[model samples]
Target chain A: MQGMIWLLGFLIGASPDSVAQQIMWRVYNRPSFQDMHAQITMTLIDPNGTQRVRKMETWSKKDPKTGETKMLIKFMEPADLRGTAFLIYQHKDREDDMWFYLPALRKTKRLAASGKSGAFMGSDFSNYDIGGGEYEDWNYRLLREEDLDGIPCWVIEALPKSPDVEKKSGYSKEIRWVNKENDLVVRTDHYDRSEMLYKRTVVKDAVQIQGIWFERVIEATDLDSGHRTVMEFTDIRVNQGLPDDLFSIRALGR
Target chain B: MAISWLMVLLAYTHLGGYLRFESFVRVDSGYQIHKLATTLQLRTTLDQPGISGFSALNLIMDRRAPDPVIFRPIELYLTFHRGPVDLTLGKKILTWGAGVFVSPSDFVNPWDFSVLYSDLEEFREGIEVADFAYYRGNAFVELAFLPMFRPNTYPLPSLQIPVPAGPDTFVVFMDGTHPVLPEPTLKKGEGFLRVGGTWGPMDFRLLAFRGFDRDPDLQVRYVWLPGSNPQEHPPDTIHLRPEYRPVWMGAGTLTWIVGPWELHADVAYVRTEDTDGTLPTVKNPYVYGAFGFFRSFWNDQWSLGLDLLVKRIFAFGQTPEDPMGVNALLEEQARMLNFQYEETQPSLAFHLQGSDTRDLWRWSASGIYDLRAREGFLLATLSYAWADGVSLQVGGLFSGRKGRSPFSQMGRHLGQVGFLEARWSF
Candidate 1:
C-alpha cells in the first residue's frame, strides 16, 4: 500500500514536513478500477465569448457489496438538455444520493444533497466538482515543490475541515496541483467564501487508459464570472463489468 | 399520409424536434391581435433488441383557428424489453405523481386545456395505453390500460347561452356543447395500478384508478324560440349536455430529502357518482391533496417552489330549493367544469425560478391562491437562451377574482393571455 504508507512514515520519525503530509494523503487516496465509461464534452464559455455545447454519458460503479459509488449521467447534447438524467450515490459515511431525470418531466426528481455547492450544469464544475471531495473532508497541506507545465509538481493546500465542510464545499480554500509523476490532479485554485480567488482548474490531456491515469482535458475558470468550463474526455471505459443495471433507478429514465 | 409516413421515418430515425413561434397580444384595450401560432414537433427513436419505438408529432398553425391546420398524434409508444419485464403499446405519455403544478397521481392523459398556461409538458394528451412494467431492485410495478377516452381540450368551443327573453330581455345561443364519449367498450376501459420505490431519502408512489371523468357531467336541454307573430316573443334554449361518469381513485406519492428541503406529498381519494351527495348532475366524493416544498438558491441559480392544494367534499348535499330558479340556471352553466363548487377547496402555489450566470438569462414567477375561492393566478416569464436550440420568450397571464369563484367563472370566461415566444430544437 505505497510501501505500507512509506514504512509507516519511516518508523514514525516522520517529519520533512510530515513527509509532505504523507504526500497529501497519497494524493487524496488514489487508486482506481471498478467500472467507468465516459464520453463527455462540455464547453460553456460566456464572458461575451458565447459558447454553450454539452453532450454526456457517464456510468460509474464501485459497489462490490455496497462500498457505494454509483453515478450515471446522460444528457447527450444540449437539445435543452436532451433526455436529462443524473444520479449519484457516493457514500462512505453519508450524504450523497441524488437523482433528477426530467425528460420533459417524465419525472424522477429526488435531489438535494444540500446542493453540494451547486453550479454543475451551469458548469463551473461544482457538486463538489463532480464528486471527488472527501479525504476526511479536507485538511491536506504540502504546498511547495514546483514545475507544473514541465511536469513534476505537488502543491496541495486544501483546508475545509468542517462548518459542514465549509458549508458543503462552496469552498474556502483549495489549491491543488499534485502529479509528481502520476498522482494526477494537475491544477485547481477555487477559494470563495470571501477567501477570494474563486475558481480555476486546468488539468489537460493525460492518457494511459487500461493502466488507469486518465484526465483528458478539463478547464473550469470563472475568476469572478468571466465564465468558462471545458471538460472533454471521451469513450474512456475502465474495468468493463458495468451493469448493476447501469446504476439502476431504472437506469434513470432510460 | 401518416404525416407523410412520419416524414419518411424522420430520415431513418433517432430524430427529435421542436419549432415554436407564438405571438399573442391582448392588452384588453388597444393592442388586440390575440394569437398567431406555429408549432411543429416531431420525435422519433426506434432501437431494437427486444423492440422499442417511439414517435411524437404535433403541428399546429393557428391564426385563431377555425381550421388552420392542426394534426396531433403526440406519442406512439411500443416498448417490449424482457428480463424484468416491460411491455408498452401505442399512444402514451404517462406521468404519475410527485406534484409540481399538480399531479394528484396523475390520471392517464387528458388536459390540453388548449394549452392553458402552456408547456407543462404541453398540457399532456396522449392516451391509448397498455403499459405493464416490472423491475425489482429499485422497485417498480406499473400496469396501465386505458384504451380510448380522451377529453379535456377546451378553449371554449361554443357556449354563450343567456336566454330569457322579456322584461329585461335576453336571447343569445351558441351552445355546441358536445361530449358524451365512452363506448369503445373493452368494458369501457381505463385503468391504472402503480407501486413505486426508492427508500432511503424516500420517494414513493402508489396509485389505483378506474377512470372516466376527465371532466364532463352536466345535462340539461331545453329549446323553444318560436315567435314572429305566431307566439309573441317566446324564447328559451339552454342546452348543455356533456355527461361521462365512472370514477374511483386512490393515489399517493411522497418524496422527501430533508436537508436542503425537498418534501412533497400528493394524495387522492375520489369516488363519485354522488356517493351520498344529492346528484345535481353528480360530483361529490373527493379528497385530493398536495403539499410541497422544494428549494435551491444562489448556487443553484435560484429555485423555489411551494404548494398546498387540498380539496374535500364528501356528501356535501343540499340544493333542492329552486322554486322557479330553474335549478339555479342549470347550476350556473355547470360552473365551467373546474367543478368542486365548495366544501373546503384550498389552493396556494408559488414558483420562483431563476437563471443568469451565463445560463443566458431566464426568469419566472408563479402564483395561485384560490383560498376559499377568492381566486387568483398570476404568471410571469422572461427568457433568452438564444442558441443551442434557440429561445426567446416573454409572458404574462393574470387573474384575480371574487366574483363568486369557480375561478371567478373561469376568470369571467378566459380573459387574460399575453405572450411572445420563439423556439427551435433539434
Candidate 2:
C-alpha cells in the first residue's frame, strides 16, 4: 500500500540524528536544477486599513546531484526598500552563513547566522523558507496511506527542526503526503501552535519531464483566514547551465 | 567605513540629491567618543504620517579614537528596507508604532537604532537594539529590545565637564552638555522588554524601560488654543520631562495605505513602572494618548506628509507621561554637568501659568513636509510647537512653598518653545 511506501521513505530519513548533517540533500534533493528566478509580490495590511505592496526578485541554482545551492533575493520596488539583497549557500555542520547588501550604506556585511528566521522582504517567508527548499527539514514518520487528487500517497507526520531550525515558521509540524508511484511529496498539512492543522497544501500536475518529476501546480490554503496562494510553475527547465556569479551581490542591478 | 560615506556623497551628487552629516562628541560612557566620525545622512520620505513623512539615513563611522577608547563595537549602520517589521543590527533603527499621536515610550534603546522617531536624538543609541519587528497580517505586533549592559554614564546636561581626573585623564568637553539619558552601564543587567503586536486591526504594544530622558529637542503644539492661556503654550502637551521615566508600554496602531496616500493613527496606554523608584513619580498612574497621520505621494519623486500626537498623565508625582513638560530624571542628573539654567518655579495659577499640576498632559503633532520629490534640489517644512502650563506645585514638593519649591530645579519646566529646520544635503 501507499502507507507502506511512505513509511519506507520516513523510516529511511528518520534520524541522521543528534549530530549535524546536510539533511536537505537526503530529504528534498532534486537533480539537474536550472537557474531559477522568481518575481515575488508581497502585500501587508495594517490595522489602520493601510496596505503596503512590495516586489521581490529572487535567483537561485541547484546542481541537483551534489546538492550545491546558491541564492540571491532583493527588493525591486518601494523607494525605501529599493536595493537589498540576501546571499546564502548550501552548508553542513553549522547553519549557512548570510550576508546582506544594504543600499543605504552601499556595503555588503555579514549578518549573524542566528538571524536566519528574520523576515525576508518583510514577508511571511523566512530564512527557513530558504532552506534550500528541502523536503526533509521536517521530521517525517509514516502516519497513514491516502490519495490526493487521484494519485495514491503515504501520509507522514513531520515536525520542522526547531526554533533553531527556522524563525517565524507558521507551522510546528506538517503532515505530508508522498506519492507512492513517484518518490516526490505531493501534499502537506501544516499545524499551528496547538498542533492543530491550520493549513493544507495540494500539489498536482506532476510529470517527469526530461527524467525529473516535478509538480506543476501548488495550492496552499490557510484554515483560519481562508487566504490561499496557488503557485504555478511554468518554463521549469532543469539543468540549464548557470554561472556561479549569477548568485552574487554584483548581479543585483542587472 | 570611508567607502560608506563616499557612496553617500556620490549618491547625492550623481543622483542629484542632498545629504547632511553630524557627529556629536561628549564623554558619558568611560570617556569614549559618542558620535566619533560623522553621521552621513540623506533622509527623504515616501509616505507621510498625519502630516508625517518617511525618511532614512546612514549613521556612519562612529569610531572612538585609540588614545582613550572604551569600546566601539558599533561601527556603521546601513538600511535597505522600509516596511512594517524593520530588521537591523550593528547600527540601525528597530522602530514600532506610527510614531504619530500616541506612542508608549521613546527611549532610545541599547540597540543603536531602536527608536527612530522625531522625539529621539538617535535611534542608534542606548542599548543596541538587537532586532525589531512589526507584523500586521491578520495578526500584528511590534517590539524592540536589546542588551542593557554597557559602560555607565548619567544623563548630565549640566555635568558636561569630563571627570577632572579620570583614567588616561583627558577633557575635550569641560561641561557635560551630553544629549539625553545616561551613557551605559553593565550593572543595569538585562534591559526592559518592549513588545507590541496586533490581532485583526486593534493596535497593541508594550515597553520595558530602565533609565529616562527629557523632552525631545522638538515637539508639536496647537498654535492657537480656544481659551486656556496665551502665555501658557503653543497648543501641545506631554513634555518629555526629566525623570527616572521607566515603564513597560503596550499599544496598537491602525493605518490605511492607498496607492499613494497613507492615513494612519495609533493609541497607547502605558504603565510607567520601573525596577527602582529612583524617578520622581513612584506610584505614577497610567497614561493615555493618541496620534493621527496622513501622507500623499506623487510618483516616486513628489510627496507630502503630516503627524500629530496627544498624551494624558492621569495622576500625581512627576507623571512621566505628562508629555507636555520634560524628563525630570535627566535634569537632576544634569546637575553633575555644566549647563545653563533659569531659576523660577512653575505657577499652579492654571489660568496664567502655561503648565498643569501633576495630572494630564499631551504632545500635539510630529511631522516634516516634503520639499523635493525626485532629487533633493530643495525641501522645507513649516512646524510650530508650544507647551502651555503652570505647576500649581512643582510635582507636589513645591506645592505650598514659593521659594523652597525647588526653584533651582524649577529652572526647568520652561513654558514652551518651537523650531524650524531647512536642510540641503548634497
Candidate 3:
C-alpha cells in the first residue's frame, strides 16, 4: 500500500498541472461528433474600417480509432480565388500534412512544416492557430479565476516547452480565458517572440449543436497593424457521417 | 454590329463584359516605338435545370495597326449535363495537357504566337468543336471533334526577321505573298480523345490526336534572279510558300505527390506524313517531353517551380556527302522556324512567385534558357493591389544570346522593352 501511494504520487507530479490540465481538457474535449460541415464567411477589416468578405465551405471529420482529424476547405467567392482548395490532415503525435490546389495552374502543391507560422488566407489567424497546435507542446499554468463580462472564467497562461516549438509557432505565449459554464475559450491574447501582445481573439454566440458547444462567431484583431478579421459560421451540421473519400487528395480537384 | 448583337443576346441571357486598354513602348538603340490597344469583351450565360450556355465576344482596336479594329468570337458554347454524361458544342478553347509552361499534348486550339510576350493564357484562340465527356467516380473520358481548321498566327516580318547589311550582300528581303490555306470543310475535321483519372494519390491521362500541324512549313518555290546578273543584282527575291501537313500524335501526362513536393511529366510523340525525309519542305517525326517539380514554402507566401524540356527528331533531312549541302538545307529549315534536328535541343525554365499575407502585393519572375541555341529570355513583374479590383503592374523583359540565334534576333529588334499597366475589374 505504501509503494502504491508513492507511485501514484510520482505519476501525478510528472504530469501537467492538474488544475490547468483539467480546464484545458474540458475545453478541448467536446461532445462526440463524427463529422462537421459548414459554410463560413470571413470579413477582413482594415484600419480605416473598410472590409473585404470571402466565402468558403468547410468539411471536417475525426477518425475515432486513430484520433486523427482531416479538414478540407474550398473557396467559393472572389472570382480570382474561386476553385482553390486546401486540405489538411492532423495527427496526434507527429507533424501535420497539408496540400493546396490552385485552379489556374491545375496543379496541387504541398506545404512544408514551417508553413504553419504563416497567415491563413490573409486573415489575422495563422495556419497553426487554424490547425490547432499540439496541446502537450506547451506548459500550462492556471493564473486566476474571475468573472469576465458577467461569466465566470479561469484565466490560464501557456508557454512553449521547447525552443523548437516556439520557433515553429507565431506566438511565444498565449493567455486564454476559459468559460467555466461550458468549457469554451471566451478570449485569448497571443504574445509575440518579444513578449508583446500581438493579437487578441474573442468568441461569441455560443450555442449547443448535437449536444456540443460551438462558437458561431469569432473575431481576431491585430494589435500592431490595426487590422481585424471576423468569421461567421452558418448552415452548420454535426455528426453527418461524411465519407472518408471527401478528405482525400482527389476531392481537392473536384 | 457587335454591340447590337450583344444587346439582342442580353435580352434573352445574362450579360457581362469588361473593357481593357493598354499601352506598350519600346526604348532601345536610339529608337522609340509605341503601341496602344483597347479591348472589349462581352460575355453571356444562360442556365436552366440541366442545360447551360455561355458566349464571349472580343473586339480589339489598335492605334498603330493597318486594320485598326477587329472582331472575334472567342467562346460560344452550350453544355448539356445529365447524370454521367456531358456534351458541349460550338467554338471553345480546350486545354488538354497538364504542363504548366509547355503543353506538348494540347493540340485542340491553335494559338496566336504574336502575343508570346503576354500572359500564356492569352495565347489561345478558340475553335469550333463538338465535345463529349463521361464521368464515373474519379475517372473521366473526353472526346472532341473539330469541324474547322484554324492555323497558328505568327508575328509580322519586322518582328520575326531582321535584315543586316553585309560587305558582299546588297539587299535581301522575303516577298510578302499570301500562302494557300486549307479549305474549311467537314471532311478536313480533326479528332481528339483523352482518358484521365486520379487513382491512389496520382493523376494520369492518356491522349491521342489526329490533326494538322498548326505551324506551317516553308517551301521555297524559286529564287528570282535580279537583272540576270549576279554582280549587278541589287535586290534578290526569295519566293516561299507556307504548307500545313497532317500529323498523328500520342501523348501522356502524370502527376504524383511525394511528401512535400509534387512532380509532373508530359510527353508526346508526333509522326508526320513525310516519313523518309525525302521532301525538304516537310518536317520529320519528333518527340517532345517535359518534366517539372513544384513546391511552396513560408506558408504559401512563396512558391518555386522548375521545368526541363527536350525535343528530339527521329530523322534529319537527306544526308549528303558534301557538308555544304547539309549546311544549306539546315539554314533553309532554320529560316522556317523549324527545330534544328542535327543537334538535340534542350531547354530549362524556372518560375518564382511570392506574395505577402494580405495578398496586397505580389511579385514573380520567370526565365527560360535554351541550351542548344545558347539563348534565353527573362521576364519579371511586380504588382500592387491598390484597391479590391484595381491593380498596377511594372515589369521588364530582357533577352540574351551568344550567337545569331532566334532569341538574339528578337532582342535586336525588340530590345529591352519596359511596360507599366493599370487594370480595373468589376
Winner by TM-score:
3
- Candidate 2 wrong stretches, greater than 4 Å: A1-27, A41-54, A63-66, A78-80, A115-126, A130-139, A160-172, A204-211, A215-217, A227-238, A252-254, B1-426
Q: Per-residue lDDT tens digits of candidate 1, residues B233-277?
A: 333655566667888888888988887888899888978777886
Q: Could you give candidate 3's per-residue lDDT for residues B226-301 as a string of tens digits?
A: 4466443322443445667788899998877665566788899988875766556567778888898877787779
Best by DockQ: 3
Task: Locate the minimum summed-lDDT window of 10 residues in model 2 chain B.
Answer: B344-353
Better by lDDT, candidate 3 or 2: 3
For model 1, the docking class works out as incorrect
DockQ of the candidate models in sequence: 0.23, 0.01, 0.24
Q: How do the residues B1-426 of candidate 2 rate in per-residue lDDT, one tens digit apiece?
A: 999987764544312122222233222224333333433444442322212122344444435434432322222332233444444444333334444322334433332211122123242332454454443431323343444533223332322222222122222222234333434565443344545433322333455544333221211122334575635442322222222334444454554433223445555554544223233323333443334433322111122334443334333333253333323533333322211122211111000111111112211222222111111111112321111111111111111111121222221321111222222333
Candidate achieving higher DockQ, 1 or 2: 1
Candidate 3 Cα RMSD after full superposition onto the native fold (Å) = 6.4
Clashing pairs in 3: none
Per-residue accuracy of model 3 over A171-202 as CA lDDT, tens digit each = 89999998877788899999988999999989
TM-score of each candidate? 0.34, 0.36, 0.79
**Candidate ranking (lDDT, best to worst):** 1, 3, 2
TM-score of 1: 0.34
Q: Lowest summed-lDDT stretch of 10 residues in model 1 chain B?
A: B401-410
